[model samples]
Target: MSQPLTAVSLSGVTKDFGRVRAVRGVDLELQQGEVVAFLGPNGAGKTTTIDMILGLSKPTSGEVRVLGIEPRAAIARGLVAAVMQTGGLLKDLTVRETVEYTRSLFVDTKPTDEVLATAGITEIADRKVAKCSGGEQQRLRFAMALLSDPALLLLDEPTTGMDVEGRRAFWQSIRQDAKKGRTVLFATHYLEEADQYADRIVLVSHGTIVADGTGSQIKSLASGRVVRVTWENADTEAITRLGGVDDVEVRGDQVYIHAKDSDTVAKYLLTQTSARDLEITAKGLEDAFLSLTGTTDSTDSTHSTEGAQS
Candidate 1:
């Protein structure tokens, strides 16, 4: 089967700040009704790319389109709704009042009760925004965004302050929105969140897309099974004798071998007289992300202005 036409497309997009190139030659496509998670370390230009797509920042070079027209044009039609990291609703207004106010801006809005329920904030709908907890406030923000019934949802860390259950509830609501053919582009620090909710994952590093595909597809890039073995001696000679193991590291009394096949490699290790205890493990998404991004926590760079409301 053929892939569907994309809802948003970015081609050869580049953005710069003075002498620094924030985002460099970035390209991305988000399909209609598809949920894609945008991931990157702090300075990876994930926010810059999203800003370009949202038309908050103009790209120094390249093309960006959302819902067929330009992103700004889409926003003008009320087809796109964005829930930023901060400040989308009135701080003084009650949760219900905020929803009602945002609803007034859109011709077609979801019912306040329904939106509150969808965001798992029904109980606090009457509470003042200033009095709400961080998670409650996040839910209220989402409720306000969904009030417009947008064709595309851009959520920047939607569940940042949510607990486990709240995050699950928020994702359930997102899935329901996707079921109705809405496109969702979310940025999250939680790997498991992307693995569970996103149909495709996009990894960004140094302002460019380094990896993009399904979770399992990206994980496949590592292409190695993990073998755990307990050796009598943490010696190089014993480690070298294990065939088919590519990356070998010894920790205390145990050794980890990364190989093509864990079972086969485990059997080989068992053949050694010193290999009394051995275990095999599979590569996980975290390992894949670290391998692909290779980003240490030092290069954090992103600045958001609380200047406008989308």
Candidate 2:
């Protein structure tokens, strides 16, 4: 297959706030029409990297480019739009007015009504931004971002504070945009959203990228195998005897075995008398994430397994 078109590229990028280093030696690439979910904990340098890419903050080192042009230049040409954490909408302005006002800034703007409808906010088009709840205000901002028909959309925690129905609505709209060859760089703390929306994922921790790949790829870093231990009268010693079992923890009657081949181990446990009632399952992405960033030392490579088993 032909190489994917590059929408955004950052090489050896670094950003510093005074004496503190926020983003260090970061290198990232976003492809045309691709959706990349940027994942990290609070203060993990996610926002800092996004700010640099958006030209809101200058990088301390290295180069950053968007759409073959600097992000600042892209913004000038109305090729990039951002949905920041604060929404940034005039509280008193109505939704239609907000979209219309932003549309005026761009020479080629999506029609106000069309933008409202695309964002699922047409019913509330005439409502003042201040009157809308947090989720509605966010949807309004999303409508404004699309008003310019930007090629690259930068979203920081876009679905935050939205109800389940609202989030589903927002993503449905975003998926339509992706189908049109628009690139999206989304920053979110919600891993499930990343798994669902992102074609690829970049995991950051402590001012550096710890992992970058598809959800399965990242999960494979720590091995994508869960050890589900079920027992009738599961004793701690009996649970530990299962071969290939790594970390074993018990809660109530269930024993959680973090292992490589849980299926084989569960069968092995079944042979033992203590494991008369036994069940074992596989691991998931959540385990990989917790084992990596959630551990005491974020850089530990103890659990770094190569490719995932699918």
Candidate 3:
């Protein structure tokens, strides 16, 4: 039998928990070998939608298909696997023992050494799970997920507790795996990870998808650039009143202005004001995320988890 061209599909899918409608009319698709990022603010239904795709919960309406079949059916066939933020580990077991134990549950599985190497945890194979760092444990989970050699991998906040170097190393492994034609859908609060790693980014807001495209394309939707200047006596109200200016922020002697016409703002700052050290730059993924999601504080506690929806 031939594999399906579409790795995952969701059409008008909605999930309701009593009075709460978590996911609302979501329509999405992922092609084989595509690395896609699923991003949204807290309580935006990202994790709820992921649960439906994993067959842990059924949708209240519409459909979700994995590898052109029901999600459970795809999982049963060993075509799908997930690496969640935490859990599913035995603290007493060594890293190698954990993978070996998981492999026993599958009829056919990747070799323990191969999976450990692929997840970048071969050196820690003999280390007990409880002794592993947060990043090392995540790698162990990745190795276990690969035991089935799944074609589609779903990761939810995979780097939640890792340090800078750990996050970098983890993503390096992910990039290498992507080259082998695996489809990956990851939900994360780390905007830079989505910007740097994902081939495409899907933004969800208030239970609906607000933007879907490549990182550059998504950034373009925010519709403005930012101009920064240094002036001891900065007039924030005056900058906000400037033509084409969307927002103004003042901190100490620095003023940051978001404007549709950055050139106009830059010229005004240089000529009309005592502003110095002027700079203009395009809006980045984080800018787009805030603009599209109506979120003022990107680092809100809501980012810790998807709240009630998760």
Better of 1 and 3 by lDDT: 3
Q: Which 10-residue window in model 3 sums to the lowest lDDT?
A: 297-306
Instruction: List RMSD in Å for every model shown.
Output: 4.7, 7.1, 4.5
Higher-TM-score candidate of 1 and 2? 1
Deviation from native of the Cα of residue 218 in model 2, angstroms: 1.3
Q: Model 1: runs farther than 4 Å from truth?
A: 1-5, 110-126, 226-281, 297-310
Residue-level lDDT for 7 in candidate 1: 84
Query: Which model, 1 or 3, shows the larger TM-score?
Result: 3
Candidate 2 on 1-310: residue-level lDDT in tens?
A: 9676588999999876656667778999888888999988766777778888888878899998988888899898888999976848888888888888888888888777788887889999899988998778877777788878889999988887878997887788788888898999999888899999899999987777889999989888878355555565666675567666577777876777777767766666767545545554555777677776664554422122100100
Name the Cα RMSD for model 3: 4.5
Cα lDDT tens digits, model 1, 1-310, are 8666578999999987766777889888787899999986666777777888888888999999997789898877778888887776677899888888888777777787888887788888888999987767876777777777888899898788677886787788789889888999998767888888899999887777888999899888766877787875755565556665667878887888878667666676677456757777778888878767776443534332111112
Estimate candidate 1's alpha-carbon lDDT, on a 0 to 1 scale: 0.78
- Span of 10 residues, lowest total lDDT, candidate 1: 301-310
TM-score attained by model 2: 0.77
Query: Which number leads on TM-score?
Result: 3
Give the local distance difference test score of model 2.
0.78
Candidate 1 residue pairs in backbone clash: none
Report how far off residue 84 is in candidate 1 (Å): 2.6
